[model samples]
Target: MNPTRRQVLGGTAAVVGGSLAGCLGDPGAAGGDSEGEGVFTSFFTLADFTRHVVGDVAEVQNPIPPGEMGHQYEVGSQAQVDAARSAAFVYLDIPGFQNWALDSAENLRSNHEGVTVTDALANVELREIGSGHEHGDDNHEEDHTEEHEEDTHDGGDFDPHYWTDPVRSATSVRTIGEALAEADPDNAETYRSNTDAYVEELETLDETFESELSERSIDTVVVAGHDSYQYLAARYGFEVHSPVGVSPNAEPGSAEISETIDIVDDNGIDVVLYDTFSSPRLAETIVNESNAEEAVAISSAEGTKQQWLDDGWGYVEQMKELNLPAFKAALKAE
Candidate 1:
């Protein structure tokens, strides 16, 4: 179950953080007075976004290990304690996605007097698991939607994968930028300017997706794993069919698998999409069972540290390189 927004807000007292020293010109410098203060993010995606906005003005810290899935990550007591002591702690307020951070919000505030805690999703609009336009067989969609609705964490009703949509992710960039500016007033202009530049890039990315997907004939996609691409689908006017629901932790039963296979066969889905963090077995099964010719990896932006480092793929790059191509081939776009 997911936590309610009320529960999450109950933890907030007031928002307010500090100077570390490090070279302001070098973005890669370690945390210190010369560099700036430490800004802790709950996941790599947020950290990546923050880095883009803050540059070398503040040192961004993403405690979640590279390659580890952020949704399933459980912060240790020591780590939690240490994070609370940072200059600013940025976390997704989506309850089910980052339950530990939501639970620790109040504690993080109480224990650390000067630390600022910002909910990156505070101003972003979130989607519910099955709230958007429906696709696929009516019966199967209903069953899966019901299952997702029941899978709550403090009673919240939103999908936390907004980063999958570059346009939607711009909202987060703004939220994070404002938080950073507030935390370090000295670099406020830089943060705002950087955010504007990044948002422009995101807007361009959104236009590309709109133009490309609009020209595609196929309107449905089958993901063998969880249905994390709902935001992308909704934004671009496509329907996503997945065996599992929104949360990756929720396992699909045999009946669900069979239904997904049916969707693949009926739609002539050429490629089954799977996230980098998911097991390929389910995608392989669907491909083998149906006429689907292949399977491809679509990053959910929850990639491991080593993968991101090795690939050097940023959020926009992942969508442009991996997701866009996969969607084009799967949909048989011109």
Candidate 2:
């Protein structure tokens, strides 16, 4: 069963910055723009939501640049201090995925008194990456170690890609809307109305995905990137197998790579799925080495918001385009 948005937000209760609880009343008490320069966050998607809600009231700065993968971003000392100094509020993922963002938030809050930090996942539930049920004991330790390395390397706490799932993403949008309204009370009505409309659109997208992919024949997918896809896997029925761990930078061991090839071959996988942030090289290698004929790039939409915007692909549209084919291929067996 899909968890409620409230359940997802509940997960962020563990986030640091005890200050967030009190500031929820008036985020603007620190500093927010009546006109411009309302910084949103590390992930471009959050900015997308902020734009939808805040509308013309505030312009958001999505600090992370294009092609700069958030999972591996390292904030410099001066950069961290500067981001804190300039922005009124800093929105970030609290789970291990954006630990660097969280670390930056902590530094910013401690240094400057007014900047409010909001966790995107604070109200969104998390999907476990490569759940143990599929990988078993042999891969459990390795997965854990890889998750740690990814977390340390990027400054994330848990899995930061919670927005991959539409349900959680809608919740995030609402949260941002509420925060923006609080930040700038004058435009509260507009923010609230925008969020309501966007949330409705999100609901439509979720319905489309559930209807489209729910009856598909394919059940298992093999991926090389290992940048997390738990939300998508959980939303649909597919079991995702990856050679690397949470951090896409982590290389898969030769043995694991071989094992993934065997799994793909043994299962007669129709295609190898790769995401935007991942190197398709390993997937290509596996397909070539195993003599598999099919391969495709499925957007996990991680670190690819600009591409989506540029391509005129919104969440529902992109997911449908990228995922429907795989489901059609996989479900054909049913």
Candidate 3:
């Protein structure tokens, strides 16, 4: 639950002291000015987009920080606490790409009663496995976890990887823009303008993906890690084949593992795509068994601190690198 706009303003402005810093710029990792207009506590990838959309109006703070692994992030540190305390509003993906964020949001709320937490997944409609568009059977392989214990092989209740789809990415930008406007009314117009520009860029990215990918002959099977790419699979007509579900931490059963391998064999999938944030252990094993050459890394919703900063990569550039290669490869897959 989020605090109202009035509550954030009228209540305590006791935010943790910090300056605006990015993953690549600072020596200590998290560094910025002690003073700023407002704070946006974002998880990972959305942080970059929020920064772009919010521009100078708000300083974005990532709970998981840059250079850190998003899947392995846990709460209970001074930095996390300070970020929460200072944030006027925080963005959380309820289905959850970040384990710490789920717990941290609650704890942050308890300490900073005025801090507003918005669940980005709340309004978006979700799709079941093989439900969105059928290129073939929904051969999505996922890791075994309590969340997937009753897993109907469905995409599960929470696929926090929604940003894989540019449309959803654009939607998140709008949501952040609205929140920023509410938090800083003086800069509302700026936020709107920023969002409009970013959305146009996303639309163009979507066009690029469709124009390139739609021409491919084999749309049936694409292999990647679990829970990271449903939005992408849905947006295009390709079927996602994964070795694990959304949580990279979850271990798939032997049977589930075998099934995924079989698909890679049958579909002739050549590349094993891993995100920049996660280890390629599972992807490598899958490649070994399926004879799919080797691992190819793509940026998930967010990227490593340095990767985001080094490449001067933002949302659009990241997506282009992620999907374009696959689109070209799919064309080659006979």
Candidate 4:
């Protein structure tokens, strides 16, 4: 009943200019050393992947603080300063997704000679965020007004949810390994080895998803918040329907909510999945109005929750424990 299939995920920058430019200067000047100046990632997910690749060879730091959305969190210039002191900054360099990161990466490449900037999104064929009523009336299209400033970062255009797809993430694991090996050539072997092991796990996860979702009673999964599962849907052959589009800030209108409820009723779906990061009111309403019996929580893993950290639930755990069961229930997969 499924119709589909699923690639590699590069870009690393080398900075060779002035002496680390003030705070990000040399060891003595910048108050940093090889051990202290480790790899700094843009957010939790990247940090998790980078940590796996580095394997204690180099410390991995996520500049985004806890309880903050990685896409829209405002850390001002502190993240740049901290990252500049590191051997590398790992972040997706796609424009509009993380404009500040793009700017900061450029700064590191241009001014910080000791730092390496790697764009995890390099060579990735990003999907555009599309609009329409998935199972609703064909004549109704959601408004694309003066919002969606973060298509990926929190806005629209190319969907920046590739990390959600384990197949693509396996490729990203290698990309990070390559970047780290290049940054610290002495441990290139270790980085490569770690990357290989981690990638194997990711590929296995991809297989789990494929095998689990291949034969499903339903073809679509409806979310009550902003859609973050395009990569997952595309990779696994299911479509994601949501009232919200790219921007997390945008609120769903009454019409959108009514249609999403209609979708749940039309599909005979019993479970409604909601982004853990977004408010659950919309999902609760959808469940109340439709035949859906329960609302489920599925995190994107872009940020972390205290409980998630307490349980040591990284990206893989989040996907398996949270998303996997939710999809299995909603899609009625065998």
TM-score of each prediction: 0.83, 0.76, 0.74, 0.83
Of 2 and 3, which scores higher on lDDT?
2
- Write the residue-wise lDDT of candidate 2 on 250-282 in tens digits: 888899999988988788786777775556788
TM-score of 3: 0.74
TM-score of 2: 0.76
Q: Candidate 4, which ten residues in sequence have the lowest lDDT sum?
A: 1-10
TM-score of 1: 0.83
List ranges where model 3 is wrong by over 4 Å: 1-37, 67-69, 93-116, 128-156, 222-224, 330-334
Q: Which candidate number maximizes lDDT?
A: 4
Q: Model 4: clashing residue pairs?
A: 97-153, 149-155, 150-154, 150-155, 151-155, 151-156
Clash number for each model: 23, 19, 10, 6
- Across 88-142, the per-residue lDDT of candidate 4 in tens digits comes to 7778744455666766766776677556666665444466568421221111112
Winner on TM-score between 2 and 4 is: 4
Q: What digit string (tens of lDDT, one per residue) describes model 3 on residues 1-334?
A: 2232112222212122122232111212244322223454555676777787777655577666566645545646664565454544454433234545545455555665444454444334444444453221111112213243234333344455667888877876776666555544456688789989988999998888887777665555444564577778678878776667666566777787788778876777677676666677777888887867767777665545666667787667767876578545743432
Can you write out model 1's per-residue Cα lDDT over 117-207, one digit (the tens) per residue?
Answer: 7667654556655776323222211222213323464214556787888876898888777766655556778888999999999999999
The weakest ten consecutive residues by lDDT in model 1 span 5-14
